[model samples]
Target: MGHIIDISHHQDPTKMNYDKLSAQLDLVIVRTQYGSRVIDKHYKTHHREFQKRGIPTAAYAWVRGISLNDMKVEAIDFYQRTKEFNPTFWFLDVEEESMKDMRAGVSAYVRALRNCGAKKVGIYVGHHLYKKFNLNLNEVDAIWIPHYGKNNGQVTSQPSFPCDIHQYTDKGRLEGYSGYLDLNRLMGTKPLEFFTGKEVVKVDKKDEIKKDKPSDWAKEAWEWAKKEGFLDGTRPKEPVTREELAVVLQRLVKKLG
Candidate 1:
């Protein structure tokens, strides 16, 4: 049972008394960039302010990719900006029809972040885009879905996935800020440290962080794939086709069974 908030350049950190707001929130996700070139004006301000108050922080990059190659480039740019922040989590903000091939574009973006050593990469998407892209969400660590209601900060239709976080309202009123803010709830029991990349004891804060070790299911699938020669003894730094993916999945399933 935790409360979280997302802020962009729209939310003025200087105007809001963070000391007062910190009491009401456990974590903050700041918007760091919009695509490859444009940096969000308020990102550094909000990030520093939130950390100054000892609130856990993460980051999201608003993606605008016109094609798979474009998305990969944008992702690399995003990774460079956010990697310095050492946020417990990082998310790709997916909206609009910017990507020409939605599936390949999205997949490339996620893979790029992983390659950049983002330990806890996630996706921020609405239900419509989720289904439209038929996104293979298992590739990422978290899913943040947004659903707002007609009334003040109330959510009418809940997201279908057991979301790690839900942005329930955009019209939320807070005491320290004059304008409405995006409000979220963390659905899982993992505490703020879990999201902040601080849970691991041995890692140095400044070093390039790798994603947490794979889950038992993922390990099993990997072992099965390797045993059956499905991986072909190479790790590709490039994207794989859907047909190739289907064959691998089918082979892994049969081997596991």
Candidate 2:
């Protein structure tokens, strides 16, 4: 697998070697803005450059709102500004405690993004605040947690929580840039398609029903099973799982008893 790096105004865009950088990257996450007020100056340039090289790109905005309204405003601004770039995912970077009730504020921000027609939204949280904020994890499509260990450009430790992506180090060095960079790795079972909006869920043939209706020979039995509440009357041609079989057997035994 290639590398995933995030860059902002700090990582001077002019000095970056696009050709070399594009060769080594699986994806690039560019900062769009810091809340609603301060936009990242180099965001557009970074997006254009990375996209020119056919590299997959995503965008993130640092959340800095103190109120629910502020969070919504920031979300709208972030989406409006970066939507033209067509980022694979829009991420909210929540680090500092900008609001007293972070859970409510962050939830508002995520909802705002959803209203803005963003199909894929993710959040990046400081590892330390993972348990402290207690934000609703189900609201977002993915979670990215940062736990830089040793900070020597190598991934020394992983985050303790379950996350979709992990930012292993902030001092990471790559050939395309002179300064340090934030490096991330895909964690758990999520594939790259999950982030890129190209995921094709594979269904097992055994799990799928061959036809909409049951075969003539089994139609009567299927109807009887459904009438008896032993089966759900769906997917008549599908193979039953062991658990389902056990449940049906138990129901039969109970009826006989």
Candidate 3:
């Protein structure tokens, strides 16, 4: 409804200027730098500042790659640290240029966070990538789109609301980086989770495995939940059972109608 400003130290905090940002934003997602990037460093200092200011906040990372390995590292670290702050949601800043042909792995990072017990997670993508990746909107959260495209909403081809936040113009000419950051009011959302169905590829990581494979219908149900915003992420466990499978199928069919 108000705004969801993504705060990051790497971007220059003074550029944010909380006095101005607070006035324009409702939710502040500070980059805790949770991922496995030891080269540079960041902390939850901004999250504390926002909390003191009484702003609803969360944390995220500049996710570089979309592999299960990349997610596993960041997911474990981000969750372990944020047990204290306990923000509203988590995000994988799916930046452009960095994400190329990794569409299939988009769900990897999200799944990792889910496995670590992250309740709410979402993507921060602009128009360029949303279109570039040929996104499956039904399986993900609303886009944190930042664009000046004349017909921005036209391309998505869904009912115009595909985009949640619009970083209308970065480097706000007026506030000097205190630009307009719009967001859709998040409703009925929860933390994100991740579970793996793929084979245990690593010799050392054989512990995490679902003995039986999932049926076609069970996998279909998963896809459905993801698209409908019911599923947060995946975890490693035995395949969905016939009884559990029946319940999900019935629910989905009812929802479809």
RMSD of 2: 13.9
Write the candidate numbers in order of decreasing lDDT.
Answer: 2, 1, 3
lDDT of 1: 0.79
Candidate with best TM-score: 2
lDDT measured at residue 96 in model 3 versus the true structure, 0 to 100? 49
How accurate locally is residue 125 in candidate 3, as Cα lDDT from 0 to 100? 71
Model 1 segments more than 4 A misplaced:
188-193, 198-257
Distance from true location, Cα of 213 in model 2, Å: 36
Instruction: Evaluate model 3: give its lDDT.
Output: 0.57
- CA error at residue 108 for candidate 3, angstroms: 1.6
lDDT of 3 at 211: 26
Q: Go through the candidates in order and give each one's C-alpha lDDT.
A: 0.79, 0.91, 0.57
Clash counts per candidate, in order, are 2, 0, 16
lDDT of 3 at 121: 70
Cα RMSD of all models vs. native, in order, equals 19.5, 13.9, 19.0
- The TM-scores of all predictions, comma-separated, are 0.72, 0.77, 0.55
